[model samples]
Target: MEKMILNYKEEELIGKIASVDTGTAIAFIPDDKKMSELQINQLIAVNSPRAGTHIIGMVVKMSRRLDETILQNDIDDKKNDDNVVLPSNAIKLVFVGELRDKEGIKVNVFKRNVTALPNIQSSCFRIDGDKLTKLMECISTIAANAVTPLSLGKYFIDENSTAYIDGDKLFQRHAAIVGSTGSGKSYCVAKLIEQMAELKSVNAVLFDIHGEYSDESFKRDGITQLKIAAPNDLETANKLDKGILMVPYWLLNYEEMQALLLDRSDSNAPNQAMQLSKQIMTAKKSIVKGTEYESKITLDSPIAYDLNAVLQELHKLDTAKEQGARGEKAGPFNGKLTRFNQRLENKMSDKRVGFMFSLTNEEQELDWLQKFCRQLMGTSKFNNGGIKVIDFSEVPSDILPLVIGLVARIIFSVQQWSAKEKRHPIALLCDEAHLYVEQNESIDAVSAIGLKSFERIAKEGRKYGVSLVIISQRPCEVNKTVLSQCNNFISLRLTNVEDQNTIKRLLPDNLGNIADNLALLDIGEAIVVGDATLLPSRIKVEEPKIKPQSNTVQFWQVWGKNDSTQDLDTAVENIIKQSKSE
Candidate 1:
């Protein structure tokens, strides 16, 4: 008891609690006090009867209101006295956690439930300088012992101490990094990748939707950059080369293939789908003959087959004629499979989708799937390959979701089928997730197939040693199921009200007020929350050693000093070719 009193006496008391509510305590300030000393979001402590513990709260709002009578008098009189003071001045603080000692070690441990609210008129003291630094150090020590701590930035209240989150939980539980454009979302991702790169065996695949991360500046020993095969590269791409990614059509399951070619509006869609599935199964079976997996392979197996054979079979079905009651009549599938065949042929012939449909005939080899799996899910520590960043910039937007879904489905399937002991944990960093994972209300069969693939992975990926780091600028646009599955969030400044509200709704009720500063935050600063962080904190993310190519252009400076840069003709040609610009 004496020690408690001594500690409280040594601290500078700010005010006394005037009232206590559910999770907030109101404190009245004395007129003589300098209000400028107190800051919103600053941590403070309330004296508790407990022997060695104090109730910690965060200052969220402060207001000074004059009485009606005082305001009327001042308005009636020509002049008002400057010395007069308002009577209703108070500060509201939300109880965050408790600062206490355990086993002789003092730390700021977060707890959602509070045993007791501060007593009315209890003294409040500001936490600053040495006291704040010591508390942070204790928390840091606790986090260090509990999990693999990753240093993010300095704590908002005590800049002298660094902030950290559990690196293990951050990935294992899944995470999202969200912010508006130019608010450092990409930088935060770069920072995380940089930290993970320090680990010798870390395997992360970043789907570069816009090809922004393929910069030569990020080239390093551990970083292996690759791109989806373009229309022109299909003929020359070597089957064994890992630098060019070609996802054969054989990898897509029945539903996914339907998504790409099945047009629900057609009256014979059902017949077309049935014939397509049957032909694909037969095609796969024919290719696996004499192979070890021949007896085990299923219709959905990732076994390459001759797409042309399937087309030929469909053509025969559409043209077949069988004897009827009187004379030769059309077959059951005659003309029904014609439109489906046309759609399939069109998709296969389209050069833009070469990555999915234009693989060399060597893809039919029995070892093709095995080799691609090793190239994708393999780790640098064991296989001398790591950190594959596949650029999807050349993919058309209409089928972007389906294409990305194919890759994710493949990765998940590989991870799921591998022996538990032999599985290498992989993290899929999805940049611009909203583009593919956004909600689609059209009820189209095509959209639902892609949506379901990602939804399943979001729900069950963690148990199979697969993690996702979804990066997006519009939290509202991203799928709710995917966002809800994420247990950690590193949210930068979000100016949109809907986006802000989406993030706010995800927070616990007790700390909902903390999100009020979301729009007010500066660039590179984010509110870190969820299971990975010991406490919900605002941290300034450190700049990555090698940044991504996401920096905003300096329009004003560029316009001030412009020069002749003649490259539009080549750009137009590249656009027409539907390929990357040289």
Candidate 2:
């Protein structure tokens, strides 16, 4: 191949170097006629003092042309007198050095050859033309080879040299998918997870709050799907195949327990929570004679400390009568006695009084509480699997935090036990991580496990085979510490300045220009950064072949419907017949 070259006359004006930026260098182009066409981001070659050498650099920017009147008049007079007017376009050339080597330094310098100068039309350095095409092509080839492991059939490449996906690396630490509301964050997450699942080595757990994943019947892939409902739906709840979601009290460390149970102001709250955990474990072991300490406890076991029981105990401690000369003492033993008495009294009382007491006193609600807790932490013997979903859809909003915390604690405990042998690497994917990490909310359990345990996993998870995937729309709403620890990031379109800035700070310095490209990203397109990619890539994310379609409702079409009487008599008859059979 013939070498393309640009020759500059030594007599031409060589203006001084102006400025240098991250991706480009700027210099004053002295030629007045060609200055108007000197656009930003043009490519140019720098001629060095050394012979037969040329350095390639892109023109990131150009200095403004200095307006002068005498120079124009002199040119006009020369043109009319048949005197050749020197081409003002040959003034000066500013060039940015390209990374010719892996270290990204400018070593090759352009050597000017005055004897064999090419004509202006034959010159490779021209304004408003694609100078970086060769360099972009080189980078694009590297990115294309990086994604070979993903097996993405075909993808459209962006013309602007902004986005590409590198699928060659393992993403075993932590990752987050973030974007605006309509920016396809969820679709990207689903697609990414789907691809991961296709990798036979990967085992993932997705916490789907919207029930959108229930349509797994669409994909006949090898996946176990389970739906947990409130204990009310006995038929469906009983049919779930996965084991029940149970967190043994003994599993939480001191700090995690404090976050779960104690008030924030309580100086010894963490210690107390730890003590409470130990006591609960001891009591359960004593209750169930055969179960060993720290062993997995089933829902049917008598030793299991029902959530209702724990709450009832707490209530008793709160409302205990001070031990005067004649009054009962306020302690664990006395509290348990009081709780037992309260239960006995409620059982013996009249229907109205019992009902009122059960509704009013927290201690009196123990029986129903036990049932509720059992439903959440119980195991199904039918398929010999635990019930993973407690079906909190029927759970009241106030106590949702408690349920969430309890479940998180359980997951942490299971992982902690397996951490010793390095078995069964568990990954916890928090869909709306912002909600749990929010400052105001009482997500102590999740915060404890997330910050302490999950953060630890983020830092050292790859070694232990543990990982975390946090998906959130508002990056600003998430904890900065946790966000900073993520080794991988799949950022989608984010219009919010704060969210954009957060991503900007997390990405490496070389990717600053790539971060600016987020706003223009299309749906399902993302700028992938961090450990998983060799470089920041504009990846055209593949959509899951069998993903649940959860787009917004078409209100206009629904509103176009006309009212009609559709056999109310048959509906009522069917309801009555169903009730009779029940």
Clash count for each candidate, listed in order shown:
0, 21
Q: All predictions: root-mean-square deviation over Cα? A: 5.5, 11.8
Q: What does candidate 2's lDDT look like per residue over 1-582, in tens digits? A: 222323344543233233232332234456566566654334455443334433444342233433443334433343431132323232223332322322223322222122222222222234122334444444445555542344222222335453334443334657778888777776776665555555443445555555555454333353434433332223223222332232233333445444544554655444445445555555555545563534665332333344345545545654566666877666543333443334434432423222111222222222433443333333332221221212222333333344444455445454555647755554556666675544334454535454454445556666655566778889888877668778778888888988898898887553454576678788767777676553345666666675654665667876788964458877686454332111
**What lDDT would each prediction earn against the true structure?**
0.79, 0.47
Judge candidate 1 against the unseen true structure and give its global Cα lDDT, from 0 to 1: 0.79
**Which portions of model 2 show Cα errors greater than 4 Å?**
1-24, 27-148, 151-170, 216-219, 233-279, 287-426, 439-453, 557-582
lDDT (C-alpha) at residue 115 in model 2: 25
| Segments in model 1 whose C-alpha atoms lie over 4 Å from true places | 1-6, 31-35, 65-87, 104-116, 144-148, 239-242, 382-385
In model 2, where is the ten-residue run with the lowest total lDDT? Answer: 352-361
TM-score of 1: 0.91
TM-scores of all candidate predictions against the true structure: 0.91, 0.59
Best by lDDT: 1
Please, what's the RMSD in Å of model 1? 5.5
